[model samples]
Target: MKVGLYFGTFNPIHTGHLIIANHMAEYSGLDQIWMVVTPHNPLKKKSTLLEDHHRLQMVFLATEDYPKLKPSDVEFRLPQPNYTVNTLAHLQEKFPTHEFSLIMGEDNLNSLHKWKNYDVLLQNHHIYVYPRISTDKLNPEFENHPKIHMIDAPVVEISSTFIRNGVKEGKNVQPLLPHKVWQYIEHNLFYKK
Candidate 1:
């Protein structure tokens, strides 16, 4: 089986995420899109992140209805400050039968060279990059990578940061998330200030 690893903090999984994953599954050769819930992304700030377990649960709840979409806690057992290349190496070892690809945004691709062992990543795996708002300025080096492909993933300006801020301000986020996910957030009072 071919799988696309869509790694993120998922502070609270929302509809925008589901749409993208569904689109990837439907339009690409990938059979599944695993939501790799990272405990702490090495490149991102940790202070604003919710608890890893909580984030994972939200992802699970949001994606439970989609067979092609799965929520993975693979990084939980791995060492903290999770790095994509390390996770990919571990996953390939554990599931040798499956082919894995990286699903990322153009923003990440632009700075990917700075990531740990990025050359190894470029050589060993396929990358499915989605266009982001300001990726015209990508570093020239990225264009030469062997396994890079771009897909026109739908653009939704809403972000986890925006949703978190909405909750902090006691605003309704019903439109930002799916019905079940929004209910879960409300029931748990997530992001309440």
Candidate 2:
């Protein structure tokens, strides 16, 4: 089975995420799109993040209706300050029968050169790129790279940050989140800081 690893903190999984993941699952020729909930990033403010399990549960609620979309806690067990290459390697090892590819935005593609062991990543798996609204052009090196597949997916402008801020301000962000996910956040008073 082919899977597209859609990694995100999903601080709270919102609709924009679903739009992109659903697009990949339906159009990217991948059988499944795993929404990999990332552990706390050492570089980011840890206080702003929900607990790993909370974030993972929100992802589960968000993706429950989509058969091809799955919520993954694969990174939650890895050491902190994780790298994509490490997660990919671990997933590969644990699911030897599954061929995994990355589902990333075009803007991320522009900075792929900076990721740890990215050359090794390119050599081992295909990257499914979805469009992002960004001023930066995709790096010239990967423009024609066989390992990079530009998927003509929608440019979803909604972001988890936007949803969080909106919720904090008492804005009705319910429409921005999946129903169950929004209910969970509302019930828990998450992001209402």
Candidate 3:
């Protein structure tokens, strides 16, 4: 099976996430799109991140209805400040029969050089990059690279940070989130200050 791994903290999985995953599965020639919930990203701030379990639950709630989209907790057992390279390696070992590809946004591609062992990542795995609005153009070094595939998925500017802020400010965030996810957040009072 060919699986596209879409890694994120998914503090609260939103519609933007589902859209990208669905697009990749339907159009990217992949059998499945796993929304890998990173327990902690090496490059991001941890202060505002929700508990790992809570984030995982939100992902589950958001993705339960989609057969092609799966919620993964692979990074939860891995070390803190989860590095992409290590996770990719471990996943390969754990699921030897399946092929895994990385799914990311254009912004991540621009900053790919900064990731740990990024060279190995590019050389060993396929990458499907979706466009993000207002990000820097794709780096010239990766242009026409055989390993990278640019996907023309719909661009939704909404982000987890925006959702969190809206919830904290008592604004309606229902439109931005999956119905079940919004209900989960409301019942749990996540991000309430």
Q: Which candidate has the highest TM-score of all?
A: 2
- For model 3, residues 73-123, the per-residue Cα lDDT tens digits are 998899876788999899999999998999999988898989999999998
Per-residue lDDT tens digits of candidate 1, residues 132-162?
A: 7883687888785668878888975679999
Q: Could you tell which candidate, 1 or 3, scores higher by lDDT?
A: 3
Candidate-wise lDDT, in order = 0.87, 0.92, 0.91
- Those runs of model 2 whose alpha carbons end farther than 4 Å from true positions after fitting are 42-44
CA displacement after TM-score superposition, residue 143 of candidate 1 (Å): 2.1
Better of 2 and 3 by TM-score: 2
Better of 1 and 3 by TM-score: 3
C-alpha lDDT (0 to 100) for residue 72 of candidate 1: 98
Q: What local lDDT does model 1 show for residue 87? A: 93
Q: What tens-digit string does per-residue lDDT give for candidate 2 at 8-105?
A: 98988889999999999999899999999988776787776998899999999888889999999998789878889999999899999999999899
Could you tell me which residue pairs clash in candidate 2? none
| Residue 191 local lDDT, model 3 | 92
